[model samples]
Target: MGQDQDTLSVVALCQSERVLWMPDGSPHSPRFKDRYRSRSGGLAQAMTVFLAGAGLPVGWRGRNRFSVLETGFGLGLNFLCTWAAWEADPQRCERLQFASVEAFPVSAADLVRSARNAGPEDQPECSIALRLPVLAEQLAQVWQGLSPGIHQWRFAGGRVQLTLAVGEVQATLQDLDCQADAVYLDGFSPALNPQMWSAQTLHLVAQHCRPGATLATYTVARSVRERLRQLGFSVEKCPGLPPKRDRLQAVLRP
Candidate 1:
């Protein structure tokens, strides 16, 4: 026997705080009983922490091209929400490109399953959840097989494209040539996933950011803030979503 082979699929579990989570593995979000994100931060993470932190739903209103780079794709809640927002905006950017890196790619079936277990309509985050099934179904139909390189998926007549780098964070981001307008930092906690939040990883992301690029994350760690500032970002501590004190948002200072 060489090594133990592990199979991947979407599984639901309950966290200590009563949040819902898919199985903790290569690319899925960590555990939170019912929330789409890790138990540490729920919808609050996406809306108040990530979105508000980056000044989204307001940042790329009239731009010609708007590109977002993300560290972990997870269940794709952030991507879906961003897409919905763009669709709803009359003066949205001309092209929306979201590029992300993931170590493991969940099966298409799991993606659809996640949509069913996601939140309802009234919630801000739920708007993305509701559309998950439709997108997931489409993705499932087209998801042939993922190799360890950049794979692009287009939707809405080429207005939107998701470029997924199916590999480790550092190398994957290094191989990408995108100049991001915004960054969504949705990796697991620094404590649990050091590689995702490591200085090296952040530096790679910062290198690809345009002069006025914005970044948002649910973490306010001193090290993270310092690193971002050193990378030419003006960091800010903003009011966080519930159950947490604060989140971090930053902009590249030309």
Candidate 2:
């Protein structure tokens, strides 16, 4: 679609979700009744569950560019963590692209609050919190312009790029046309947010996966695993972060 047409089509905003800060400081979605990130903390979950599970840093090392597609943007913790990782790595890729879809975008204030609350105390090994506040501020500056369509932002001297599609899961995935090197399947639990884990939605996601692209998620739901398998991904269960038994990882087959 043309840029103007696409922008006009997305002018109608999806109602933003009400984000409630849990007693423990984690952000929770009232609509889904689910935590945005694990209680293990945003940075830790992004690293261990999404980055490590997808063999990031290592997978992207020496490459000219690396791109990741995420199902849910949430407070953008995953994007921040990934950007931090790329900046910290000595042999990082020349460019990092993070594309995500959020049906209900949260407010900029909530984004800042979420990062501040996700501190070292929540996950001691998570040093990314040190840079989160600044990164969050940068994201918040552009958050206000976000509409229902695709919004793009550049950071770190244009080394990092974030493309966010604000709309329904399936439609956004279908609208995106980029080859993903890694995919982070994060939203609510399958039982609570089934649309994000549905076979049809996953198939749309798979359409953007390049050969051998890796995928990871905090949930090891049988239905999710089966859907990935049917989509030609070699799915496997891996040891999860604290308080969680297992997480799912997979690689698209050539």
Candidate 3:
């Protein structure tokens, strides 16, 4: 209904099928369908759609520094999952930097409530939620301190740097100095969230990618695949999670 400092309020159109609202603040995905507005892609969706699609865990094994850029920090599910994977992996990259952009941010209490509701079966999910003592508290404390620019938060001995870009998608992406090794495209679907998936936005993301950079999302729209191709990404269709037949994955080709 409205916008917050870092969380954008989006109405869930499909609840039975678990489709949440679309993502708005990032370009990694042309259109991010909630599939369950309440939880916004839940744990399975994120693990299958973005993480598996991008070839993570395995992808982060050897690199010294691994950077993941995401749009829509909703509930911080994707972020927590990614971080847990990194922490659990012995071969994980030495430095893990996760940068996400969101226009409306919810309160830390809300995040905790969401995670608790998500349940214990969601191991990494609940684990990350419970383990978030200092960082999560800091996030809650500074929820209202967000302004229209880049805000950096360091955690886990400063190895994890979360940069919140607080503005419109295009403007924020333009202002960030991020060259991502992996991009998590979690925007609302193009039909409902056009601005996030516009061709121009993809181009901007491409500009920030070094050759061979990878991108993944849960959308298989023709326009999205074509746009990514136009931006120098080699696109492919892969098996999606339950219900969805195919999702898109692309690699930046020099």
Candidate 4:
């Protein structure tokens, strides 16, 4: 345990996750030509597109452990929202494991900024408004010492843990050894970040999921739907939040 803690500081430096704050306060990825989340709010997207879509909170109830794997970490809004929801849920799983892969991770400051600027000024954050900033601070505290490898951190008295893989998506996912109960397929648009949404990447993602793992994503692209169908996922389009009309939800068949 001591050796493991010592190695957590062995992170080499790499710079990425460049963002241009849009006029509406959304983080825009110039490389991907897409916004991370809309001005509508990151929390809202996490709660609706991901948490609700995956049947979380309810899904994890009564389980001793639940894990979620994500294709793109982005600004980490989804993880935060999920953590907050788990804390609020009376019947949440005993342990919540979240693992995410990000080819280009943002600065620690950006992570906290993203959370602070979560929602529009007119509207408060979706839920956990009071706790969002606090959670962001906790994440930022350990955001330092990140490199092109896995950086695992324990939180909520070790009941909640985040495994952030900082490297190319495929290679990182290959290194990750977690059987996810749910999966979040999030990133820039399929057209923008082809690698993240590619068929081969999706295949690797499937390898990490247990049988009957649930999946949620904010895209209804026909190609994605077809590819997931081929992967033994019962895919369907569900009602989406704007600026999207429909979102995709899938369940891996046993």
lDDT of candidate 2 over 1-254, digit per residue (tens): 35235334544644455799878788887767888988878778988999999998899999999999999998988898898888889999999999999877888999888878776674555557777878999999988856677889899999999999988788788888779999999978999888789899999999999999999999999999999999999999999998999998999999
Give model 2's clash tally: 0
**In candidate 1, how many clashes are counted?**
6
Candidate 2 — which residues are off by over 4 angstroms?
1-15, 122-126
Candidate that would win on lDDT: 2
By lDDT, is 2 or 3 better?
Answer: 2
lDDT of 3 at 122: 36
Q: What is candidate 1's CA lDDT for residue 75?
A: 63
Per-residue C-alpha lDDT of model 1 across residues 148-240, encoded as one tens digit per residue: 678899987899988988766887899997999899887777766677888999999999999999999878989899999988999998877
Which ranking of candidates, highest TM-score first?
2, 4, 1, 3
Task: Give lDDT for model 4.
Answer: 0.85
Better of 1 and 3 by lDDT: 1
lDDT per model vs. reference: 0.72, 0.87, 0.67, 0.85
Q: What TM-score goes with each of the models?
A: 0.82, 0.92, 0.79, 0.92
Candidate 3 residue lDDT tens string, 63-174 = 8888898876756667766776677678888888888776545556655444444433536545544543434454566555555578887766777677778666777899
